[model samples]
Target: MPDDEPALAAQRQHWERTFAARAGMFGSDASAPARAAALAFREAGLRTVLELGGGQGRDSVFLAASGFEVHALDYAQAGVAAIQRAAEAAGVARRLTAAQHDVREPLPAADGAFDACYAHMLFCMALTTRELLALSREVLRVLRPGGLCVYTVRNTSDPDFGRGVHRGEALYENQGFIVHFFDRAKVERLAAGYELLGVEEFEEGALPRRLFRVTLRMPLR
Candidate 1:
């Protein structure tokens, strides 16, 4: 992709077509980690939230239904539109707002605009660590002081599973997108400002089919 080009539009189109073709795969329930993170915030007294890179607004819809006022951002137009439609259909449209925004740029919202923010499977797909750190800083910029930011990234130390596997040191590219790999230590260093609340790893299938999963939280100071 060129420097001025926005890859998100293509990405959004790809997912939109996929979801439309297989709506059954786009389950109404939130992902395991997203649900766990949201429940954690609820237990900690957070009702207002922001979701960055909230593709198709699955988690945003769920959070809004659970009584959270959600501002969901995605660079893909289709993804944002899908979220809007879904929110309307779910009758929580008033609780949710979806917009097209890039994480690489400064967020339009004011400082301390949200009590919490959540992202799922977003960071790992970046082409570089700098991109990931830039996105992380943007998340920190929009969050309230001492608020929480929760998200997941692939673990690097896991055996080379067939999923997202690359031939060499070059980052993995799928459908013209790049995904950077990281282990726990690198992620901790990248998210230095936030306290590392937790880290977990898991495998999906046997070696060549396994995926390493890590979840962590950072507190905005």
Candidate 2:
């Protein structure tokens, strides 16, 4: 955390190992947020989606099946492979592509390459505020004007908040996984140049992680 490259490397390694050891660790269910995002993206008349942090590809398969061309990225190689396999299994491989990427770096897409962007829980990873800001800008750059972006993040109100090893900058470590928790102010901060269309509170998992489902739109200018 704290924008330290060494720490980020460690975090990436941890995730890589975890994903390698636990294929489909998150199971094959498309998250509730992803399901809702599909409808919202469809309603917005979106055709292409760039999905970040597509762990195991459940959302990738589902979105492709829902008729959206999806390009999914994951930091872990295993996760990216999982997505490809899931896409093939679901017979949506033609509509879905998977790649390994780290969001802290520049996105591997041209400006205005995608009609929409989606992320299930990528913003809450072991990322610093500065890194999150840069990532938001990258997401902005990759989207077409008026394109929508739907993402979810674990919020400060979550039950596990402040319960683990403090990693500075509102980040805490639990079970060897670091998470950068967001508050409403932080969410608004990242919405900088975009229109913050919606922020809805929701819960997920057995711990019932409290999160905010956020939607943003780029200006048509």
Candidate 3:
């Protein structure tokens, strides 16, 4: 909601309309990045997850079915509603909670509340570098010590990296949507207060965008 940025309300409407236009945006199966997060979480013996940008609840439902308690947040009310409906349909409503939440705002959960946080492409959303840093701090705040933050970002090497109008910083306004691309240095910088565990590259979508699955961990005090 910065003066130079798109209004938050407008952003919410954009996503709402995008979802309304189709029966589904993302399909029923969770994205590969999310599946990978599930594996990592299970290996780490983590149970509770806080998901940011939980569009349409595909991943949230999948994670809940995988036996994790999930709190899924999306900016658009439509998206949150979709999540709620999907959770009910999947009979994971007891394990899943959906809410409309803007990641730019402080997380609603209490400190040290979550064992892991997942975001498929939340970091690459149309947010300023400062906002990303603040969001990172918020993630650290809500996660217990040694908790993990697993997220994906369209990296500089992505096929659509330079396809749209450049927006001053690493951001590009592509087809009315904004994406802030990331590089390794940028990822590390945003993860300043956390321990950088790894960055794995993968291709997704018909465009096969080159994305980085960056994993960070909050240090134990």
Steric collisions counted per model: 1, 0, 0
lDDT of 3 by residue, 15-121 (tens): 88897776467889989988999999999999999999999999999999999999999998889899999999999999999998888899999999999999999
Off by over 4 Å in 2: 1-5
Q: Which residue pairs overlap in candidate 1's backbone?
A: 162-208
Candidate 1, which segments miss by more than 4 Å at Cα?
Answer: 1-25, 157-170, 175-177, 203-221
Score candidate 1 by lDDT.
0.68
For residue 212, what is the lDDT in candidate 2?
97
- In model 3, the Cα lDDT at residue 48 comes to 99
Q: Which portions of model 3 show Cα errors greater than 4 Å?
A: 1-4, 7-9
Q: Which predicted model would earn the best lDDT?
A: 2
Clashing pairs in 3: none
Can you write out model 2's per-residue Cα lDDT over 77-151, one digit (the tens) per residue? 889988999998999999999999999999999999999999988999988888899999999999999999999
TM-score of each: 0.80, 0.97, 0.95
- By lDDT, rank the candidates, best first: 2, 3, 1
Best by TM-score: 2
Number of the candidate with higher TM-score, 1 or 2: 2
Candidate models: Cα lDDT each: 0.68, 0.92, 0.90
Q: TM-score for model 2?
A: 0.97
| TM-score, prediction 1 | 0.80
